[model samples]
Target: MKKFLATLTASSMLLLAACGQEGEKSGASTSGGGGGSGDKVIEVWHIETGEREKYFENVATQFEKANPGTDIKLLRIPNDAFKQKLSVAMSGGNPPDVFQSWGGGWLKNFVEQGSVTDITEQVDAAQFHKNAIANTTFDDKVYGVPLGISTNLVFYNKEIFAKYNLEEPKTWDEFVNVIETLKKNDIIPLSLANKTKWPGAYYLMDITSRLAGPELFESAFKRTGRGFDDPAYVEAGKYIQDLVKMDAFNPGFNGLPYDEGGSRQLLYTGQAAMINTTNSFINNIRAEAPEFEEKLGFFPFPSLPGGKGEMTHVPANTGPVFSVSTKAEEPKLAAEFLNLMTTKENAQIYTDTTGSLTAVNDAAPNDETMKPIYDYLATATHMQMPYDQTLPPELAEVHKDTTQALFGLSMTPEEAAKQMEAKAKEMLDK
Candidate 1:
């Protein structure tokens, strides 16, 4: 980090003095540089933080240095705070040149409002991963570049598993049996906190697809006049409630803040046996206890007992992306900065340092916790983008709320099913 910074600090001082006269005449933020386009600056914003924060800042600094005539500024916001800030900024017509975004139906609203620059032609489609790129497209036009990608991971503690002589589960029945066995031994089957709402919905999204199969969810989401209460979703929800009834999740898991339940800490301390989380958690584990580097293991969401979809059915997404805004002054510079930030070298570096999965097909996972999920996707007969991304924003929020209520044992499969059906119909009436 220090080495990376030293080179940047040294070059800027000299670049500044030489460009002083040019800076005034050229109209660019940096006199002679700024991509030879003159005064415009490339401003990039994102919510990547912690180990990933350095990763982003390092890339921005390098992009500026590599293309010396250019001035690039990166703002890394805390994730918890980004959504609110981004909304306000974009509404005021002061959106950043490029910023991280998920490829959800919400993006449709952004695209329709002309808030994001369509980069379909600016970037080489062939260079980006096909699956990653596919998710970002709307009405056959692309608007963003891939920054990072991730998959849901089943993380288990090795020492705890070894002590219990537990074999990692490969199938859904096996997984349920293991949970039952663990319960018999007085271990909380797993740590889950539905109070955070989205986590519960995400779990339902990932696992229900495992039980009900992909086509059902896709069909329901695609809106051929059907809705979320489809038989498959109800069955899946029932299965979820079954898990809840087993007293499976930790006591008061419904009340715990998803992240603060010390859920990751649970795996680290052997207090809990497993956590179903994004591969990103691997880095947190490594940071909390270095020895876990060897103890950490991963498994995919298992195949359903009687479902048609193979165990290879996995949920995946380009974690988020940076889109150029139409209101921005520096279109060319924004494109240039986008290219630099997502260069495979930097992408791999960030993945390595933060234990993240990259969006590149050729990039290797930073660690073992993600390998199984990646391997499954490579051969997956079917992979679904998470429903949150696939569904309209209004409908997605309903699912989130319903899933949250379900986990609290307040909404049954039938009731949740009815709520979703009403929502889909309400939206379809448009």
Candidate 2:
């Protein structure tokens, strides 16, 4: 369980080191494409590999073929490596023409540094969902185009629920009862792997949204009226601890990983009744346990009584936001490539090939398993970006770490909330 340590501070340090140095020019060829005369090359860096990498390559080839004398260089980097490499590139003042981003506080840093280009005029904002566009926009200016949208949901084994004569819960009390019933039946109520830390964060995030609503959470993160030490966050952590006391998650969940023979395996083997994870887990079910796919169903996080948030306010955000660099050799052409990537045709291809929802308004999944997700996003009033993506990198790490501690019973809810507030004030109060 190696932690990914490429934080905003690491990138800022690199930026400081490279300052006043004559770094290589932006859009310069590093590996791909031939430097032929009179050719316009748009270098794009992304963290897509395997089948998804092939999709990007195909798009580049198509774009190249359609526009002669233009080269679309695709640099596919692994997830962990991409963060470090992209940070170094940004700091060195030679960023790619188009690059992948998560488009919250991460992109906001680059935008504030003038490292990213604003394509608000060129991009048709009306073509995307408001939530998708909202993630990429800063200070009322659009800095990127979102490729797809993703959200967290509770995926349950319908067969297990049927065996216990249980139905999906709509309220917190009902959800707790469902958990107690599963526990009594000797079923693990939730399959959570928190070794990487982010998995456990979903609980606190969803609970906070339900209890305090999005406004208070936003204000806390932004260091406005309320702060992270608010009773709401502590209450959310207490709720998670209550679940822990109920033996809701698999044994040694904090030591388990999400991939391979871990929490997901528990669900596949029918040892676990449910898993609260992102919609992407649907793909895992299809790939790893096709037989279990039929038994899988999903539902929104149950609402809390007297909560300020609506059930429609989901914990979600755009998948991968692509932005053109301000240092791009051909800024207009770079913008064009981004536009091409999200077009209805390419978006449909993205959806069909990836089994995920694209940010394009017209492109949606037609499958029975995925249609509910599409419907959820269609009606969602607020798509709350994950804390790890929305908060500054350092603060985000504290969040994950504290949430993991909460799940492990290593820290009290009040202690965790205070720690988070202390860090938030140090980082955000300036």
Candidate 3:
């Protein structure tokens, strides 16, 4: 939906257009800036496409003006191609001076490989949220600056709830009951953005933690030596299957693109009562349909009975991470850019524009889109990284594919969990 600039291919438009490119991956298509910056350029790459691209581009321009001697070579790429291009750059010893990375699975590989420079000493840990800091830390070392922090919150259509006289669910049974009631009334209970693999996996992660607490998913996925197909993960899968059987998900979920699947639009259109998405959906809805804000409200995902997880506990993680290359020539300038870029002002700009929450303690959410995330982050008793981000790439992708299959009724909950375990073993054993 919203992309950051660090995912770019470092391509210059003029160069690419002239090549009349046939099979030649014309354009810079790599790195953030031109090397040997005659003017000391710091290359920054991300996937800030759509309207938000201009916002961050402005942030870069501001930084350059503030620092005078510094210039940021900004490249914005498509999300699907970012990781592949980033890998090529890092392996070739010409990584961008600063780039966008987060969601632990991606960051960890580079951090472990020493491809990224550690910003711990330069960054004040006290200035950031502990939950975010924890996500970016490895081997007790902080490897990246959390670009933002986010918490999962359930978004419900107030009009639908009032029309049905339904209260926001507080526990698993009530949540299921609510879904059933909505289905019986000929309404979709949930708007799911499963067309993209991550959204389906998002639901699994949400329930697994609430059903089994953060410990199970965290331990299992994070290689804490715990089993992946435990009762908790299985039980969560079953719940997902139960909802699927009731036909609770919005129509066209599997067919629609992530943003278009109506996960963000359903509540706006009253086609679905609620959506399982990040706080960013709040902003998306407002921009897509402003009147929906009056009809929208949010709640933390309810906890299952007899679970260690709190009803208030949410799926949370560092919003995004910013890191620099270990081979950068302008290291101090990069640090200054990082420092200047994360101040409450810049954080506010990015968060306000993207509907993300700042990791910095003093930065208050300026937009209503992030209000729910902020509320949960401030009040939740506990939070955990999503299973996808907590686990290695292979395990995380397994969760993604299996979770989507389970919702599509192609796999039973127990079968999904068992397969997850098999996959985990296969990957971890090596």
Candidate 4:
């Protein structure tokens, strides 16, 4: 999941409380046939705050203005609390009419539980990129509309790299050399905030893919010929531990919070030379310190010698997708609202404001800073969703926890691999 809010303000807390009360009142009528009412209320839940929240609110307002007698109730939830709240609502048989989704195993679970609406007939899948559409589709059925696309890569300080006479590394060995050089110079080679656990999982995910390829990971995830205990996974874990042992990351990174400016702050101060984070980091820097924009540089995760994965393989996926509830009182109306949210105009607004790429094929970032990302994504052969979002909820939590354990040196790479394999068997075997 993406952390949009660094810290929940008092007003946000109040909004959550109010939304909770509204959700209780609206849960009973979440789903049914459309057009049988005098006034319609579509309760929409999302984890967008700040300017993005304003954009959603503006869209809702526009929707209401265009469609009289229809009220769009917007619930802005904190990112950390969103999953728990949504899960509670879903399990209680009162999911919101439309809610934010990451649209992979996360959305797949909801579809399996019969909590998500099948929007195959309602949404025009061709309007979005195929990779973005893939995340929202299950069994050839469309269930959600993608809002944007996101990919993770290394963001380095160009000034620092120049000072050390280092260029972007294309191979794993060269990448390691760069990190070692940065560490030797008394700089944090990598800025990481693993207090939330998901940040560190990226390393394992990317390294495993680079070493053994996405096919192996997918096969292991599907419990086919491969398993999580494969050498690729263990090696990935070992790679992370090796970095930890070498003091590659900042001190106390395990306890730091990414949303609270933990890693980005280091980058801003030139104390950390690099951070492997999603493209949203560009928007974050633009928002926090526009002056540092020129100092920023990006590169994809380095390839491994003899590895099955190619350089074009990337850890990427659609940003938050929107799915309607299976039980929505006005499914068609909700679908129409989703359409309104994803219109070309709105998508352009989203791209312009967020400094990110919208899922809409026609909407792209105009900023030069995002051009490299756009270009890289254009040629990406394999876009991998984050492991936490790709795995079932229980398994996802275990992956994150064990990955964190690796960062903390509390578990050996082999032990972590075995632990993941055991969980996979326990979850998938059933």
Candidate 5:
């Protein structure tokens, strides 16, 4: 099964590479001069492509205009290649001035190694969401500026809910009732694309939040407790299997590809009642089925009965953070660019283009369809970063692989927990 998954991923990457080659200048490119006239060239690296890349370029152009004698060199890399390239550059003492980061253990490693600079004074923490700032901060010092916030929740079709007389569920039991009702009505209860694995992992993330609360995961991440072997972790896997047993996901869900619109297609056509995904999904729905946007309703993950997790706790994280390298030629200019990029005006430009949640305070998109997300965030008691981002890379991969296997019914919940614990222990012991 692992070999099969590897083949699938490689094939996908090959196809992506082919597409990227055809659109050479668009998806990835480097822009800047060699060196001349004592000009300060601040190199910036990012993984966003298409309109997102364009947005960053426009902002860079704006910053250059605002600050003469400093060239903001932009290097756009494909997501698959960006991380490796950045790691190599950083380790080789030639890192970019600013680069994309998903803050957590990943950023902490750079922080501890002194590859990234501490920008505590340059940033005003109060200008961003607490969760965003927290994600980028380490040891009481800020290392990066958050670009956006992402929350995973159940997005439902309002028309389907109204037809079935279902209200937004507050508890796990009520959530199950909605699922059963949808299934009885011959509608797919949920739309999922597990081909990439991470989409399916969201289920385990939300369930774990409900079953064990944030402290258990944090303690485990900090290497203080049972780690992934905790009973709560096992129980979260059981809930995922429970959903699988109930036929909660669409047919061929495990085989579907998210980037290819397999799952969003189901919801757009009303074949599925709901989809568990993040704010990034909004762009897909709008592009595929613009008319259906009005029917989309966002709700927080329902709480579990007698659970230690707060109902207000959410599985969320800020999107890619922009961090300056400690080895930059012009650290001050790079720092200034970071500030320029995160200003309310520029942040809103990102929110407007992507329909995603921005990290800048009061910068949430004003679209009515996105209002529910903001409303939920306003009262959220906690923001649990996605496990794949918060956990060490090796353990994170194990989490994804095990959760996918659980979804496929190839492994029991307890077995999945044991596998995760074993991997966590092996990695930490090394």
Candidate 6:
């Protein structure tokens, strides 16, 4: 069933690519040095800006120094422009030597369209975490190498929690009590930026996994049973509405942007008590509110009573992955560059500079506050991908849009579930 779903997703990608996209080619540029005499230039497209951009540039410089002849032409694109630009580039038959990817459905599309090169025999698959490897694998072959990994959790201000005498909740009921207490004390309980829609979908993903367990996700993706209209999905919607009624989220959350210092600002400045987000959010804190360092704390999303889900189960993925493009002028060199980027030395640099966990076995971030969260993910029994990214593109959008409307009080839990189920059926039936 999983194989069938994968094939279906790949076919859909082929259809989209063949249809062609309409947009002016993006105005992105390559800034790395040209190759040595007689050496090949490996063009790379990545979606890292600020500190991470410099980190990758340094990695490329080291790779060129070691390889002597191969030069990396690195092009950094902003996240909003990345997908469309990459798609157009591939459809136009000029894919980069290496590009950033999220694997799962996103990579599968490129693999089907022959935009990504298969590197199963060229790289060591065992060096990365098992979950990380799985995300980049299709048809028993590796198409990309993981750069780093991420896991989601609730980041809170310790000073605020202690000020209210609130303990980190261990179960759903206790979590609700925490929210109610924070509200009574006139504090926003959760920092959410739903203007982008993806933020709200994370909450639904967390609760749906807890209420229904991971098998429900697999079933939905594979079209085996019940699908998105499952009782658990409806229950997840109800949970979000309950939080909404308690005034759990920050003001104008539905209009706030995640990247522009919306929720992170709320937590850093103590306008809000907690944020349920990915581990990389620490980087935001470091950049925006370095003074809040000692006051921050991390905790996994709490479990519900009688829930079959493990508290140790986390929504995690290898941070953006790097894949060699099949159309690259220097595919081997591109793959080699990818290999160099994952070396222990480079991986550690990634951790030190980004404050994000690495998929490399020993490359946990060096920050003291981030160490415990990295250690926790190291032993997690299950690492689930964000549901929206896991589903086919159409259905993923349905999940995102429906969840946002659910939060806006425009749809009942049942209505949202039915909408999601309808989209799932439309895609799966074909």
List residue ranges in candidate 6 displaced over 4 A. 1-39
- lDDT against the true structure, per candidate, is 0.72, 0.85, 0.74, 0.87, 0.83, 0.83
Q: What is the Cα root-mean-square deviation between model 3 and the actual structure?
A: 7.5
CA deviation > 4 Å runs, candidate 1: 1-40, 259-261, 366-373
Per-prediction count of colliding residue pairs? 8, 0, 20, 7, 0, 0
Q: Is candidate 3 or candidate 4 better by lDDT?
A: 4
The candidate with the higher lDDT, 3 or 5, is: 5
Residue range 300-361, candidate 2, lDDT tens digits: 99999888989989998676789999999999888888888888999888877776788888
What is the TM-score (0 to 1) of candidate 5?
0.84
- As for candidate 2, its clashing pairs are none
Provide the lowest-lDDT 10-residue window in model 2. Answer: 22-31
Ranking by TM-score: 6, 4, 2, 1, 3, 5
lDDT of 3 by residue, 82-168 (tens): 777888888978688888876487688788788888777787777778888778888777777787777777889988999999999
- Model 4 scores worst on lDDT over the 10 consecutive residues at 28-37
Please give the lDDT score for candidate 2. Answer: 0.85
Better structure of 1 and 6 per TM-score: 6
Best by lDDT: 4
Model 1 Cα RMSD, 1 decimal? 9.6
Question: How much does candidate 4 score in TM-score?
Answer: 0.89
